[model samples]
Target: MQKMKMIKRGAASVAIALLLLPMADTAHATIVKHYGVDWSKFQGNNGKWGYARDDFSISQIGGYYNGYFIDQSTYGTQVSNTIALNRRAHTYIYAQFSGRNQADQMLDYYLPKVQTPKGSIVMLDVESGNPDTDSVLYALKRVKDAGYTAVLYGYRSFLTSHLDLASIAKQYPLALAEYKDYKVTAEPDYNYFPSFDNVQLFQFTSTYVAGGLDGDVDFTGITENGYKGGNAQAPTTSTPATTTGKQLHQDTHNYTVKSGDTLSAIASRYGMTVNALVTLNGIKNANLIYPGQVLRVADSGQGSTVSQKATTTTTTSTYTIRYGDTLSGIASRYGTSISALASLNGISNPNWIYPGQLLKLSGGSSARTYTVRSGDTLSGIASRLGTSWTALKAKNGLANANLIYPGQTLYY
Candidate 1:
């Protein structure tokens, strides 16, 4: 196995204040765009998930997303990763954590990684019966601190039963979801609309249902209602058949899932829902989606699963992460786990690496921080540092300092 690596740079002034700011970007160039969709397996007779031959040039994708799914504690990584990729859309995503717990890190995780948001707009879920105004406000404050624009995602009854919109509207955008022009499903879910202190993204009606890409997509493009009133807005998405058909026919199946296939953007693209798709595919979570995996268009008429063209290949025994190695290949070469690599060190996910990333399996792990490259170990490091393996492991929280990773730091 290769050693792990760790890189530490001086914090920029902007980074220090990032946590407390609202709507801040994590990456230097990533943009924010809010997106939504009817969310199903198949595109509406008119909508699409993958790129089609006719309307490749433009689209307004919607994913099957809701507050409860977004806000769930078990779904933080799932939500954050989706939000990160969808930083390219221009529609509001109604995110909700599963439970309203103070211990939940939905606000913290999202705020810290704002640079990748597709849409700069944010809408917090205020469950209809939820009375926890303080917790909701805390999440909102984090949004402000991150420097992102804010809105409240709720129906009229939810507001009447639980929220005081007049107060929340004082500072944030209130996304009023008023169901109309609709059919009742599961429960007697109706649209909402009323006078409120603030209103931005109002849903006058939602017949558009993104059925996880498995069933027919309920499209709003042909309808007179949705996001905008009949024939409303500047850049309305046109169905493939009706538009001028200038879009390139890139088969949706061809786009392999690289590290970039975060759930949010794809769900938005096809106007399907995230959780429904995630659940349908049996994905463990959002962060774990990997390259080479062909993402099916949730429904798209039940074809065989994606198949990779078979070729002869040789498997290498093991690897040591070099000073400037990328995680993509190492994870592939060893077929080792990404989470394992992360856990071996105190490394968080997706950060770039630099010199001396000590690879745990190969070696490294002696100091408070050590950049393990190809090979390192507690015994070897301890011997060199003139310390005991027991002492070194204890210094860090390693149950076994022997399990150090490349680029990880040792005690100074």
Candidate 2:
């Protein structure tokens, strides 16, 4: 059972648009305010998907009920159709939580069948069964382990009664279902929002258009976050922008931690060592990171060495978009911004990238050299350069790879 019917509540006297307010900080900047819909087998494979103006879509994959795995027959068709229309597609599991094992079984059965990209969001629809806090948390962790952004979806009453919502909100984003009435087409009134932070999506109506379809509004861009499609190829070169008479240094960027994230994994993803991350962030314990904790991934300061060559030519490279490609994922993999890619490629819609489309990547300076630091290791340097220690040794002609000292110059 999905989106259980509830008695209609009285409409609010004043409709306050809370999400339209300015975000408190830069961490909330990625939130994409777009309308979407959640579909299930009941919706069928009809051509009337009111998706002409929608930006994202979520479809139910399956569930575990009565010790049996129930699959949603329309799951594959709906997901593929949504993607085919150039919409951001995601999947949800209608979890009937009997215990931790049942939760795992539900995910194990349905995760293999998910049709979305690797880092797309996967929601756990928890409206039925007796859901304990541990079982729900375990299921969310399982979803994250499978490489999808895990979101918890439920009505306000069900979530508050069965789980510690405050604790859960700290670790995972929430998709709350609270409607004024059935078949209502208006936007969600923020006055009736649940008493919790990290509420990324609000399910406002059951019947979005002529036919019955659950309509949702994403206040935060949780659906837009993460890699969307295609295999992300590594950039060929590491290019550092230069200024006259000034030495180039590694610029820092912020990464907000998500549920089930470990320091090692974050470090590995950013091509930095654990020790470097710890030193950069002043983290006392590497294993104590929580969701929403913003960590700086690189160093920031003036370098002691001055650049001999101040002028460099701009180099351009091309990437062929594969199946399920997205501008966001391509930009991220190439260390460029979506806006930059769109501007470079003259792409009007970032979500409408197609297979075999060629995208131009423009950046980088001349050949660069790295001066080893006191605490630097050979492998650590190679990771930062997107190369291996063996390559670094070969390029620099070092007899003893382990005997590099401080102030040693290495070319990558």
Please name the candidate that would achieve the greatest TM-score relative to the true structure.
2
| lDDT tens readout by residue for model 2, 190-218 | 55555456777788878777657788887
Residue 143 C-alpha lDDT in model 2: 90
Count backbone overlaps in model 1.
122
TM-score of every model versus the real structure: 0.33, 0.51
The models' CA-based lDDT, in order, is 0.38, 0.64
Q: lDDT per residue, candidate 1, 2-80, as tens digits?
A: 1111112233343223312442323222221122432222233223332121111111122113223232232222222
Candidate 1 residue-wise lDDT at 118? 23
What C-alpha RMSD separates each model from the true structure? 21.8, 20.6
Candidate 2 accuracy as TM-score: 0.51
Runs in model 2 with CA error above 4 Å?
1-17, 28-31, 46-48, 226-412
Q: The CA-based lDDT of model 2 is what?
A: 0.64
